[model samples]
Target chain A: MRAIVIQAPHDIRVREVPDPTIQQPTDVVLRVLRSCVCGSDLWAYRGESARRPGQRIGHEFLGIVEEAGHEVNGFAPGDLVVVPFRWSDGTCAYCAEGLTTSCPQGGFWGSVGSDGGQGEAVRVPFADGTLVKLPSAAATDDRLLTALLALSDVLGTGHHAAVGAGVRPGSTVAVVGDGAVGLCGVMAAKRLGAGRIIALGRHSARTDIARTFGATDVVAERGDAALAAVRELTRGEGAHCVIEAVGTEQSMRTAIGVVRDGGAIGYVGVPHGSGTGLDLDAMFDRNITLRGGVAPVRAYIPELLPDVLDGTIDPSPVFDLTVGLDGVADGYKAMDERTALKVLIKP
Target chain B: MRAIVIQAPHDIRVREVPDPTIQQPTDVVLRVLRSCVCGSDLWAYRGESARRPGQRIGHEFLGIVEEAGHEVNGFAPGDLVVVPFRWSDGTCAYCAEGLTTSCPQGGFWGSVGSDGGQGEAVRVPFADGTLVKLPSAAATDDRLLTALLALSDVLGTGHHAAVGAGVRPGSTVAVVGDGAVGLCGVMAAKRLGAGRIIALGRHSARTDIARTFGATDVVAERGDAALAAVRELTRGEGAHCVIEAVGTEQSMRTAIGVVRDGGAIGYVGVPHGSGTGLDLDAMFDRNITLRGGVAPVRAYIPELLPDVLDGTIDPSPVFDLTVGLDGVADGYKAMDERTALKVLIKP
Candidate 1:
């Protein structure tokens, strides 16, 4: 099997590797159908995070079940499934709490076991918990397929940001990013019944896509202008909910400053270089509610999956580029430089 | 008329000042029956806050109407009243949102006015909004004096913490700090039907008072030990609500760290100095709901005043010392060094 391996900072190469096999009672082997490079993956690819030689990469994918361990009863050969980024035992206290990403017995899909979704074939752990079955009719539906594949990551994350930020019906929400995740957040806010959605994006193309995703308004401005515009749109009350999808301090402050007196700020941007630190006394005085982390994707996939299959929500418009596995390097470079909102990879 | 004035730090003098006359149509003059030194007032005396020159001190008071201006129509001469610590116009959007403390025209007594309640006479601005008319019997009952006086600030603040922190029937609450405000929080939590109230205090006397106010367990521990004790009591799930009454970084962190996931932190402490600037990313990951601000005392006074009159909840224990207007210096000294929980002054 051929796989992409990151040897060290700024060094990634495709090489032949041994195929993965089911190792645990809950394990199932997946022959990769489609995969994509994630924003987090770039952290290591760009030398922002350390990566060892020959390590398997990627946590997003949709695929066919190549084989199932004897104990894995629900899944069988040739079954279509979308695998979330994290694998967890569904019965653990944390998993039961809807925080499957932080389950004690769970681990990141790409880091712990045989392989990651970015490769030819990867072994999924706790298959019953990590894999969401796609209906046969929508299995080959490219638009639905892409959206379902995204449910493994960005789409679920966008929904988490909206819900955690307390976006509600009639709420005015300000989304603070232009990436695929931010685009999906506009959809999530719409699904949650937010009356008005403001998407802040610098790029014209991304701004247009945000509009298509249900953003009622788009602020091409950044920093104080963006904050001012949101406040103005809200009749100086600021937004009822603000979503931060960029991990910079400026973005965090923008999220905080643009929320109304008792509003919520939901942030999911993995801190790039520095982290998010807030003024305790100020937050205390402002009465703001902040909530968001790695998405509890598995918990929402059951409900979100049907919507994706039936075309109630199409989250894949954010994926502006698609290519064969051989062009994975170009996909990474395009995303790293902001040339593409997202890159979809096919086997 | 006699008034309590802080000539400087550590020097509070009761002296004759010009009798207060309404400067605005919304103002009303009151013949003060009683007033109490506040924990916050000690901040100026101890030089903890920026102090004004010859500042008129004292905020809590129960008094009688002496005169009313043209615009003040709610009461006539001789009606008893409980004046909130802050005066609000009542007609602003902020007030309509139930945030009277943050009302655009609202301001706390003693911080600016020269005739705050620790005097023979005082003037209340926006009297119609800040002054509530009770059945004269409930307002003048010496039996309900302390609790009614408490409704002006500390007791209402405690209720603010309980409601903001989301304590409910069968919920567990942890109160950090055992000052008068914190003790009142214990009482408020109990009234809100919290199943367990853990009061963290170092002083045995303070802890005893906390238990009397309905603390099921008194963790004489500060910092880490208090958090451990709270977690232990909640079967390792942590408290459902944490009321942070100490306005320091350590207390704020403890408040955020000790609550169970999805629990809330209601903080009311006016920030003493600089703080650790809360970690937004860490808090986002923890899934905690943080809500707090200055107490909207006027909003709670009506509900609490009746309880005080009926002798259902007693907050008078907070007024541990009594002083005549001439003894204002001693009141400051006693409260500053923790010699007294609160000092009441009879003009």
Candidate 2:
């Protein structure tokens, strides 16, 4: 089997690795049909997040179950399935509370000794609890397949941000960041009935997609300018809900600044660099709410799947570039260099 | 008129000040009947919060309307009323959204040239928006009046914390701080039908009040010990709702530590010292929510008034000491020395 591996800073490669097998009674082996390079993967690629010399990479995928353990009653071989970024036992207290990311028996796909999703075949733990079955007929549908692949992480994450922000019908939403997650957040807010969405990003191509994703307004500015533009768009009152998809201090500050008094900020961006220098005093004075974290994408997949299947939303546009397992390195490079919004991988 | 003034750090004086009159069309002159020294007042008394020499102090009061300006439509002379710490124009968008503290036209009592609540008479701006009417007959009932006075700040602030933390029926609530606000938080949690309430405080006197207010368990520990105790009380899962009534960095950390994954912290203590040293990384990883600020007490006064009137909750117990207007200095001294949980002032 071949999979993406993080060798060092700015170094990602498709290397031959041992094939994954069902090691636990609850585990199942998956033949990866589709996967992708995430903005978060860039953390390791840039050496921003530490990674071992030959560690497996990537955490998003959709696959067909090649083999199922005896304990996996919910799935069988040849069944199409979508995997959330993290695996969790559905019956755990946290999982029951819709916080699967905090499940005690859960773990990430590419942690220490696990199989990376960006490979030909990977082992999935807690199969019955982790994998959501996808329609077998959708495997041949490129558009639907890509959208379902997004459910593995990005789209679900965007939906989490929206839920955390308390987005409602007729709400004015402001989304920070123009990354794949941010674009999906625009779509998610729209799907949740947001009357208007303000996308703050300077990138033309991404902003165009944002508009198509239902962003009623676009603010191609940064810092105070962006805040001013958003405030101006919302008639100086700011948005009712702000989705923070960029996990930077400035982005967090902008999210805080552009949210209306008493409005909430749903931040799904993986915190980086000074870790969201949030000013408690300012937030208190404004009566603002800050919620969200590593999204419990597993809990959201079921609710969002029907929308993707019916084409109520087409998140596939986020994938402007596609590559095969052999070109995984190029996919990483493209995302790192900002040449692609997101890369779809055909394994 | 006489008023409590902060001459300097550790120097409180009852000084004769000019009598207040209707200043704005929306203003009303109130003959203060009851005012109280708050935990926040200690900030100015300790010189932690800078104040101008001889600045009038106090922001909680229940009084009789002495005079109403032409534009004061909701209130009239001789009407008994409770005033929130801040006065806001009810028609503002933020006020309409139930965030009276963020109203654009709102201003805090004792700010700059404004008359403080501890004064014999106060000129209240936005009278129609800031004051909640009290039944005239209860004015002579010391117990009822004391509880109603609490609705002016403490009780309402506690309710804001519970609401911000998303308190629901059957929630496990944890209150950090045993001050008047935290004690009131216990009562507020019970009012919201919380299944269990855990109070973290070291003072026996305050914790005793907490129990009567509905704390099912008391953890009289600090720092790590308190965290461990709370975790144990909730079966290592922590509380679903945490009320942070102490604004210190340590208190914020404890609130964060005792909150379960996907739980929220409603912090109402005016941030002092280094402010809430929030670790966004930890908060993000745990999916914890942080909300609440200077409470919009005016928005909650109505809902809580009926309960106070019926003796369903008696927040007046927070006032452990009482003083006349002439003994305002003694009231400040008692509270600053921690001999009093809260001081009631009669003018």
Best by lDDT: 2
TM-score per prediction, in order, is 0.92, 0.99
Which segments of model 1 are wrong by more than 4 Å?
A15-17, A70-74, A112-115, A271-277, B113-115, B273-277
Docking class of 1: acceptable
Q: Write the per-residue lDDT of candidate 1 for residues B92-144, one digit (tens) a residue.
A: 88778777876778887777654677889988888988898766776546657
Which consecutive 10 residues in model 1 chain B have the weakest lDDT in total?
B273-282
Give the alpha carbon lDDT tens digit for every residue of A170-239 in model 1. 9889998888888889999998899999998889999898898899998888778887888888888888
Q: Predict model 1's lDDT versus the native.
A: 0.82
Q: lDDT scores for all predictions?
A: 0.82, 0.91
Per-residue CA lDDT of candidate 2, range A1-347, in tens?
Answer: 89988888888888999888889999999999999999999988899889899899889999999999999999999999999999999988899988999999999878889888988989999999899999999999988999899999999999999998999999999999999999999999999999999999999999999999999999998889898999998889899899999898888889988999889999999999525457778888998899999999999988999999999999999999999988889988899999999999998
Query: How big is the RMSD of model 2?
Result: 1.1
> DockQ numbers for every candidate?
0.42, 0.76
